[model samples]
Target: MENIRIFVQKHKKVSWLVLIGYLIFCGCFVFPLSNERWSFDFEKAYMIILSYGILATLFTSLLSSNKSIHVYSISLLCTTVGMILRYIIEYGEYSNTINFTQINIIMYLGIIPVFCTLIYWIICKLESITCK
Candidate 1:
């Protein structure tokens, strides 16, 4: 369909970034952190993180479009909300203290925003290129 083609063209970079970010989060954060003691079931934590990552990627893909910034933004927002919910459900329920290891802090605060900014920049670049 023409719509699908246009959507891909507009959000290819965002899609790629989301994929890479998800991979990085899984490889760099989840895998290593799973070994740490948090007084929770590791399998459950891993599943929740994995599910959030998959949902983020899926939403990003579904909302891809040149003329739908609102939709894309909503998808991103949902992804963020899902991530926060996962964090709360996993740790908050048990009153587990959040550890601020260098890697964890960077992944949570730095990498998330970097991923978002990259997607936004790529969207702007794609729009300008298509306009010209």
Candidate 2:
């Protein structure tokens, strides 16, 4: 644990990028630049799956040491793998909608994080206000 913390502190830039990568993962992935390289409808369900992953990461972060990047790295990797496996198994129905021609950028990135952050804020508030 101490070793992990030390590593992140020593490599501040990489750690910060990794942290931001986690926070913005869903936004970047879903807000498609071009429709050809992606299937909007088939892939949209990942927003749900990865949002939960973000939720798990956020709560777990509250428990990290001062250097939280270690936890974030592990959590990010695990959550990504977990989501992929889930998609493999659950890709039946959503796949049919792959022909989607458009997506709302604001709507796609706006909704879920707002809710997730609110829930995270509540948990942090609760923890700090909890009695010793």
> Which candidate achieves the best lDDT against the true structure?
1
Error of 1 at 114 (Å): 2.1
The candidate maximizing TM-score is: 2
Compose the digit string of candidate 2's lDDT tens values, residues 47-101.
Answer: 5656645554444354442323444454445434433444454466653244222
Q: Which ten residues in a row are the worst by lDDT in model 1?
A: 26-35
lDDT of 2: 0.47
Q: Give the Cα lDDT of each candidate.
A: 0.49, 0.47
Clashes of each: 0, 0
Give the range where candidate 2 is weakest over 10 consecutive residues by summed lDDT. Answer: 96-105
TM-score of each: 0.35, 0.38
Model 2: residues with Cα > 4 Å off, grouped in runs: 1-15, 32-103, 129-132
Candidate 1, residue 17: CA error in Å? 20
lDDT of 1 by residue, 3-47 (tens): 644675588788656654664444334422322565448685667
